[model samples]
Target chain A: GQQVMQIPQYQHVQEGEDFTTYCNSSTTLSNIQWYKQRPGGHPVFLIQLVKSGEVKKQKRLTFQFGEAKKNSSLHITATQTTDVGTYFCAGIMIYNQGGKLIFGQGTELSVKP
Target chain B: EAGVAQSPRYKIIEKRQSVAFWCNPISGHATLYWYQQILGQGPKLLIQFQNNGVVDDSQLPKDRFSAERLKGVDSTLKIQPAKLEDSAVYLCASSFQTGMAAFFGQGTRLTVV
Candidate 1:
């Protein structure tokens, strides 16, 4: 079975500070996706990374996929209170004629204004 | 476009009771998934369906959990003889064919006492 592990189970940062979370997988993934879930809300798709050593940016956030396709990272520059939430990385794997997603434990971000 | 829809945003039940939750995926989406998310953790896939056929249920506890997607549109998840550890948020998501991103519903919060 594939498993994804995330570092920094919890993070507390002041407004305007920077934050980053790393995700690692036990096996190579076909693709990786990032999601954000606010308190009392459902997970929302943030972005997806497929190519090895790929990097994508959205406004103040940057996402990177490792060269080996077994790791990824999400970095937020100048965090704000609105950035407070849990971030998750999910790895997609195909086996036995089907696909499955393995999600990391998640990183809970707390931003104080 | 409408997102995935789930019924009974919250549920409270005694241990040993049975409870069910329903989900309606977005129109034309071919893939639907059910995930269980506990506090401080990422969502874990419970089941996946591709147009009314079961694709994967490897992580599901078949002894007490069951899910079905009839007509390839709406789906339901049932838990019988629930235990206190069954408390969590159940999320439903749908994605278009061939590697599209998933859209999630608000989720059903279940509390077993």
Candidate 2:
């Protein structure tokens, strides 16, 4: 039973502070993706990492895929009220069908002004 | 571009009742996925369809849950004799292909009392 695990099930940060969430998979992954879900909204695709040790950035957000492809992380700098939501990391295992995406328990984030 | 679409934004039924949710994936997307997200948790994959074929459903609770993506287009998931634990948001997502980023729809939130 392969599984994706995320650390810090919850995070609270003051506006302008930075926050980070980590993800680890029980098995090697072919690729990893990051998604953001606003309160009461659907999960939206943020970014995807395919290459080993790949790193991508979007504005104040930074994403990294481990060299082994079994772990990933998402970091956001200078939190804002609009950033209040849950961050989820999903992975596709090397042996699984390409469409069988697995997700980790999200890390709920809250920002205080 | 239009995103994935789901119907009946919310539902509430007594335990043992049956319920079904529908979804239409983005135009031209070939992959569709169904996931269950309990409150405070991440979305868990229930099944995956590639075109009109079943690619993976290892995690789906077959005893009470079933889904179909007939015609390689819109899909539906049904749960019979639902239990209180079945209370969760049913999320439908689509992707252009395997190992690609997924676009999710506003999920159908189900409450089984």
Candidate 3:
């Protein structure tokens, strides 16, 4: 079975600080997607990476996919209160029978002003 | 465009009771998914539907849970004889295809006493 694991289950940072979360998979993945869930809100898609060793950036956020396609990372620079939420990484198994995603535990980000 | 839609934003029931949640995916989407998110945990895929047909349900507790997406559109998830451990948020998501990114609904929060 394929499994995705994330580190730093919870994180608290002051406004203007930086934060990062890492994700690893037990098996190689065809692609990876990132999502964010606000407090009391549903998960929202942020971005997706397919090419190996790819890196994408959106504003102050940076996402990177490992060369092996079995790991990924999300980094937030100068975090803000609006950045408070859980960040999840979902990996699509290369040979996924159902083409379903396997989600990591997620990193809960809490920012304080 | 409208995202996925789910009903009963919140629910509370005692053990042994039965509850059902409904979901309507975005129009033109061909893949739908049901996930369970316990407090402080990431959403876990319970079932996957590829246009009204079950693609995978390996993680679903079929002994007490069941789901259906008739006509390859609207879907429903039912849980019978619920237990306290069943308290969680049920999220519905849909994507254009198995390999595409997904959009999620606000989710139905269920609390079994």
Candidate 4:
């Protein structure tokens, strides 16, 4: 069985503060994806990192994949009130048969104005 | 292109009742997944389908839960004699390929009393 663990299950910060959530997988992953779920809304795809030691950015957000492909992180800079939501990291493992996906317990982020 | 679609945005049923949720994935998508998400937690993988065939269902409760994707198009997940613990959001997602970003639909919120 594969497990993906995320840290800081809850986070609260004032506007313009920076926030980061870490994710670690018990097994190596073929790729890691990030998603966000707004309050009372569905999860939306954000970004995906494939190569080892890969780093990608989307505006104020930055995502990093570990060199071993066993961990990942998401950092949000200058958080805004509209950034309040749950951030989830999903790890995809490729097996000889197929690929299996697992999600980490999301980090709920709340930003106060 | 249309995203995943799920029916019955909300449901309320007493314990031991039966309920079913439907999902239609994006056109030409071959990978579909069903997940259970409890409050304050990330989505848990329940089952995965690859072109109307079961790929991974190890996490599904066979005794009370069942899902079917007929004609490699639409899918339906059914829960019979649901229990109080079944109160959660059932999400349907689809990806164009394995190990890729999954597009999720607005989940069906189930409240089992």
Candidate 5:
């Protein structure tokens, strides 16, 4: 059994402010995926990070994985109203236990315009 | 390519009632997953299927919940004598393989009185 914990359960900021959410897993993960769920909408795939100490960026969002592969973070710069949603991190367990993916509770974000 | 599809966007039932949800994953995806998402929480994996075979059902409440992917394409999840805690969104996702990121469907929202 594995658990992934995410910090900052709720965040509210002005439209142009920056925001970041952190995730840590109880066990080392082989890979981690991020998803976003809008209000009243289903979750949407965001990105995936593999390889230790990896960093990836999309437009205004940046994703990073720790060297130990047990922690990750998502940072959004100059957020907009459209960025309001819940961000989730899912960690894939190692040892190939039939792809056991454990998900974090999520970070709910509200962008105030 | 079409995304994962689900039926009956919403449902409402009393406690101890039975209900079912349907999902149609992507055409070529080899892995399908069912997740339950409560309000303000991330999705939790209920079951996973690999080509009509049950790969994981560790988190599923077997006493009242069951799922099947007979043809490896469409799947159904059933809950008999559901409890009030079963009021949540049932989400379906599909991936090309066991280790990849997944694409999710809109999800079925269920409410129990």
Candidate 6:
């Protein structure tokens, strides 16, 4: 069984500050994806990282996959009020037969203006 | 193209009652997944389906939870004799391929009293 863990279960930041959430998996993943969920809303697809040591950016947010494919991170620069939400990481194992997806517990972010 | 569709955005039932949630994934999507998300936590994978076939149900509580995807289009999740801990949001997502971006539907929020 694969398990994904996230750090900083809760994070609070002021406007214009930066925020980052880390994700770790017990097994080597073939690919990792990130998602965001606003309060009282459904989860939305954000990004996916496949190659090891890969880095991708979207506007003010950056996503990175570890070289060993066992971890990932999401960093948001200059957070705003609208950036408040929970971030989740899902990992897909390389040798998974049934395509089991393991999701991290998520990091809840709150931004104060 | 339509996104994943779910019925009964909300539900409230007694602890011993049974409840069922329905989901219709996006057209042409072969992979479907059901996740349970508790308050203050990320989505947990409950089951996955690939064209009406069960791919993964390792995390599903088999004693009380069951799900089915018929005709490879629509799916349903059932919880019999539900417990208070069953209060959470159930999300349905679909993807065109494995390890690809998944689009989630508006979840069904269930409250077991």
Best candidate, TM-score-wise?
A: 4
Clash counts per candidate, in order, are 0, 0, 0, 0, 0, 0
User: Chain B TM per candidate, please?
Assistant: 0.97, 0.98, 0.98, 0.98, 0.98, 0.98
Candidate with the larger lDDT of 1 and 3: 3
lDDT for each candidate structure: 0.92, 0.93, 0.94, 0.94, 0.92, 0.92
Error of 6 at A69 (Å): 0.3
**Which number leads on DockQ?**
4
Q: Which stretches in model 2 have alpha-carbon errors above 4 Å?
A: none
lDDT of 1 by residue, A1-113 (tens): 67899999999999999999999998888899999999988889999999999999999999999999999999999999999999999888776656777689999999999
| Candidate order, DockQ descending | 4, 2, 6, 3, 5, 1
Position A24, candidate 2: lDDT: 99
Give the clashing pairs for model 1: none
lDDT of 1 by residue, B1-113 (tens): 99899998999999999999999999999889999999878999999888899888999999999999999999999999899999999999998852468899999999999
TM-score of chain A in every predicted structure: 0.97, 0.95, 0.96, 0.97, 0.96, 0.96
Per-residue error at A23 for model 5, in Å?
A: 0.4
DockQ value for model 4: 0.86
User: For candidate 4, lDDT tens digit of each residue in B1-113?
Assistant: 99899999999999999999999999999999999999999999999988988888889999999999999889999999899999999999999887888999999999999
Model 6, B1-113: lDDT tens digits are: 88999988999999999999999999999899999999988889999988988888888999999999999999999999899999999999999977888999999999999
- Candidate 5 is graded, for docking, as medium
How many steric clashes does model 2 contain? 0
Better of 3 and 5 by TM-score: 3
lDDT of 6 at A64: 100
Q: Report interface Cα RMSD per prediction.
A: 1.5, 1.3, 1.1, 0.8, 1.3, 1.1
Candidate 3 local lDDT, A56-107, one digit each (tens)? 9999999999999999999999999999999999988744356777789999
lDDT for each residue of candidate 2 in B23-87, tens digit (9 for 90 to 100): 99999999999999988889999999999888889989999999999899999999998999999
Off by over 4 Å in 4: none
